[model samples]
Target: MVSRPHGGRLVRRVLPRDRLEDILRDSRGLHQLDVDDTIYRDLENIGYGVYSPLTGFLDSVELESVLLTMRLSNDLPWTIPIVLDIDEEARRSIGIGDTVLLRYGGQPVGLLMVEEVYRYDKRLYAEKVFKTTDPAHPGVARVMSMGDYLVGGSVEYIPMVRDGYEDYFLTPMETRVLFRERGWETVVAFQTRNVPHLGHEYVQKTALTFVDGLFINPVIGRKKRGDFRDEVILEAYKTLINRFYPRGSVVMSIVRYAMRYAGPREAIHHAVMRKNFGATHFIVGRDHAGVGNYYGRYEAQEIFSEFPDLGITPLFFREFFYCRGCGGMSNEKICPHDRDLRIYISGTRIRESLSRGVVPPGEMMRREVAETILSFENPFVE
Candidate 1:
C-alpha cells in the first residue's frame, strides 16, 4: 500500500519511506527520459501553500512569479517516460550543452535528455543525466558525483537502437504495466527545468489537490547551449523541495527524456507517457507542443480531446496569467485587467536578461528561481 500527504490527512501505507529510498538507491541503471518545470506544470494541478515549509519564507509575490515560469512552459512536453534496468548492458557517456536524440527503427521517435552544463567551485557537474535524446540513439547519460566532484564523463554510449536495445526502452503502455505492478494508485508527476518557481509551486500544490502522491520529476538531459547545467538545476530543485513541499507529499525523481521544441503534440505525448508511468491524470496548457509560435495558442489543449481512446485523463488549464487586481494568480474571467494585466514572457526574453547577468522579473519567476535562471547562459540565443 502507498499513502499520500493531503492537507493534514494521511492515507494508509505499506511501504515506508526508508524502504522506498533503499529500493531507489539499490535500483541502478534504468533507461529513462528526463524533464523540467515546463513539463511539470503541463502534467498536473498545483497550488500555493501546498508546501507549507517553504511557503513560510517565500513570499506570495515571489510564489506567483514561480507560477508564471511554470505556466510559460506548461504546454510544452519536457519528458517522454521510459524504463531502464540495472543489469542491462547499457552504454553510458557524458558531455555538456548538446541535445541528445533517441530513435527507434531509424525513425525519430522521442527525446532522451536535453543537456545543460554548469561550473562551480573548481568542478563542472553534468547535473540531470538521463537516457536518449532522439529515439534513434538509445544511449544513456548518467551523472555520478565524487564528493562534490562530477564523474561519469568517460563512459561510452552503447548503440541502443542498432544493438537490439529496443527491448530496454519502455513504451508508454509498458510504463503503465510497471506502475500497476507498483501499486501506486495515484501518482502526481511534477515537471521543471529552471528551478521550482512559485507558479510551479502553485501547479504542484494544485495537482496534489486531486492526486494521491507527487513526483517532483525534473529533466536532466542535454539542454540548449548556455542553459544551466544539470548540477545547478538539481541543487536548486532539491533546495526548493526540501525547504518547501511536504516530506511525504512528494517524491523527487529524474525523467531522462529530452525536449523537442514541438509544443502541443509533444504535450499530448508527455501526458500519455505519464499515464503509462501510472499517472491517472496529466496537466496540459496553452501553446503545448509549440516552438516560437509553431503551435496555435490552444493547440495543446485541443489535442488532449483527441486522446480519450488512449485511456488517459488530462487537466487542461488556461495560461496562468498574473493579474494586478487579484494580487495573485488570476485568469481573464476573474481578472478585470485581461487586456492590461496580460504579460507574455518567453525563455528568449528571460535569457536575454540572464546573459546580461540581470535577474529577471519576479513576475516571470521567483527571486531565487530567477537568480538561478539568470545565472545560467541562454542556450537558445548562444
Candidate 2:
C-alpha cells in the first residue's frame, strides 16, 4: 500500500474560491510584502500538499531545527527549511503578530500571519544545508543573495495562475488520486532535473520492475546555467514516455519547486516530497542532486541511513554504464566487465555534446529523444 503522508496528513491550505473575495478585501490596508517567483512557488507547493505538514513558512525554531537536525521542530524528517526572507526595512515595518499579504506581480498569492521575524547567518546556513560556504556553489550563492531577515508564520495559500505547462502540473493530492485510479499502491518516484538518458531509464525501469508504477516528478523552475530549459526537459520526457515506456506503467508530472543542489540534504528533501505524493518507494541514483565535486558520488545514498524512519523506501542504484561484455546496461552491482570495457552514460557529457549540436549514440540516448532535444535552437537554461 502507498505510505501515509510524511506527517500523517497532507497540507492543502489553498484558499477556497468563495472565501477569496473576503480574504482579498481584508488583506488591503495591511502590510504588503512583495515576493518573487521563487517564494510564490513555495507557497503554491505548500498549498498543494507538495510540502505536506508544513502549513506555512518555518519560524525561528523550525528553521534552527532543520538546519541543525535535518528535521522539523516536531521531529519529523524535513531536510530543507522553507522560509520567506525580507529586507531589514520590511522586517522593522512588518512587525510580529501582524497580518501581511504576499504579493507577486501585483497579485495576492498568499497571506502570512506574522508570528516571528528573525535574521539568520548566511555563511552558517550555507555550510549547514549545503556542506559548503563556497560562493560558486549555486545553493550557497542563493543563500548569499537572501534578504536580511526571515519571515515565519502559518500561511493562507492563495493559488495563482501558473501559466504554461498546464498539462504537466499535478498537485500531490491530484497525483495520489491518479495513482489510486491506476491501482498503483506501490509507486516508485524518480526525481530528476536533466533530460532523460539511457542510464536514468535503466534505473527507473529497474525500479519499476519491482513497483506498481513509476513517477517521473521533474522539478521545474529556476536552474543553473547549462541545465536543460524547463520546457525542453518536459518535452524530451514526453517523447521518451510516449515512445518507450509501457502504457499505463508510467506517469510524468512536474513539481514547480526551485532546485537547491544540496546533494545529500536535497536528496532527503526530494524523498520527503515524493513520499507526500503517495510514492511508496524513491530512487536515489549516483550523485543524486549533486553539483560539481561538492558531494561524494555515494553520499546522497549513504545519508539515507540517518533516517530509518523517513517512511519512504529509498532504492539506491550504483552508476550504470554500457558494458561491452554484458551487451547491455549494467551497474557495479551486477556487471563483471572491467572499467575499460564500459561506456559510462554521463549527463554532463551528454549535455556538452548536445550543446555543440551533436546527437549522442543510441547506446547513450535514444535517437527519438535526442532529436526532440536538438529541435530546440538552444535547450539549456541561459
Candidate 3:
C-alpha cells in the first residue's frame, strides 16, 4: 500500500488554474513585499504541497510552538518555521487583513494575505531551533541574518519560475502520479545535498532492494562554500543512474529548498517532507543533515524513534567505508575489518581532492562521478 500523506491529506495552496489570472489581476493593488531566494523557494514549495499541511508562512504562535516543541499549534510535528520574514520598513507598510504582493527578482510571483505581522527575537529563535547561539553554525547564522519582522498569511502563487531545470523539478502530486504509473507502491526517498558517493549508492540501492522504487531527491538550493553546485550534483547523479542503476527502478528529482543543517531535527523535517511526496521510507544515514561536530553521528537516526507514526520509515545506516578485508563497500556493522585496513574517505577529503583537480578514489566515488567532478573548472571554487 502507498504511504498516507502527513496530516492525512496533501495541503495544496496554489490558486486553481482557471482562477490564477484573475487572482493575479486582483493582486496588483495589494502592497508589495520583495523577497529573497529563500522565501521564494519556500513559497514555491508551500504552493506545490512540498511543504504539505502548511498553507502559508508560520504565524507568531505557530513559530513559537515549533521552536519550543517542534510541533505546530495544531500539534502536528514541524521542526522548522517557514515564516515570510521582512525588514521593519516592509512590516510597517502592511497590517492584519491586508494582502501583500510577493515578488522575487523584481518580478511578481505571488500574493500573501497578511494575517499577522510580528517581530521575532533572532538570537532566541536561533538558539531554540538550532540549539545554539553561535554564529559559526550555518543555521544560526542564517537565522541571525534574516529580517526581524515576519509576515504570516496564506499565499496564492502564480506559476513557479522554471529556471533551466524544469524537467527535474517534480511536485509532490506529480511524483505521486509518476510512482503510481510505474507500479511502485513502496517508494524510498534518499535526500542529499552532496554528490553521490559509494556510501550514498549503498544506502540508496539497499533501500531499493526492499522498495519498488528509489527517489534520489537532491536539494538544489543555496549551499555553503565548497559544496557541490546544483548543476554538478544533477549531472553526476544522471551519469550514475544511466550507467549503473537498473532502468525504471530509480527516479531523480531536484528539491529546491535551502538547507538548514539543523542536524537531528532537520532529519525529521526531511522525512516529513518526503512523506508528503509519497515516500514510504526515507534514508537517514550517519550525521544526516548535520554540520560540523554539533550532533552525534547517529543522532539523526535516533530522532526517528521519537515519532513512530511519521508516515514514513527512517532507514538508518551506519558509517560506510571500503574495507580491504571485505574487499568492498561495507558498513561498520557488517564489516569486521580493523581500522588499519579500512579506507575511509570523508566528504571533506573528496571535496579537497576535487578542488585540487583530482578525482576521489574509485572505492569512495564512482569513476564517472569523479570524472564529471574533474571536468568542471575549479568545481569547489564557488
lDDT of each: 0.44, 0.90, 0.86
TM-score of predicted structure 2: 0.95
Per candidate, the number of residue pairs that clash is 75, 0, 0
- Specify the highest-TM-score model's number: 2
Tens digits of per-residue lDDT for model 2, 220-319:
7777688799889889999999999999999999888877889999999999999999999999988889888999999999999999999999999998
Q: Which model, 1 or 2, shows the larger lDDT?
A: 2
What is the overall TM-score of model 1 with all chains considered together? 0.50
The alpha-carbon deviation from the true structure for residue 363 of candidate 1, after best TM-score superposition, in angstroms, is 2.7
Question: Mind sharing the TM-score for model 3?
Answer: 0.95
Top lDDT hit:
2
Model 3 clashing residue pairs (backbone): none
**Model 1: how far is 13 from its true place, Å?**
30
Q: What is the lDDT of residue 342 in candidate 2?
A: 93
The order of the candidates by lDDT, greatest first, is 2, 3, 1
Residue 33, candidate 3: alpha-carbon lDDT: 81
Q: Candidate 2: deviation at residue 299, Å?
A: 0.6
In the order shown, what is each candidate's alpha-carbon RMSD?
A: 17.6, 1.6, 1.8
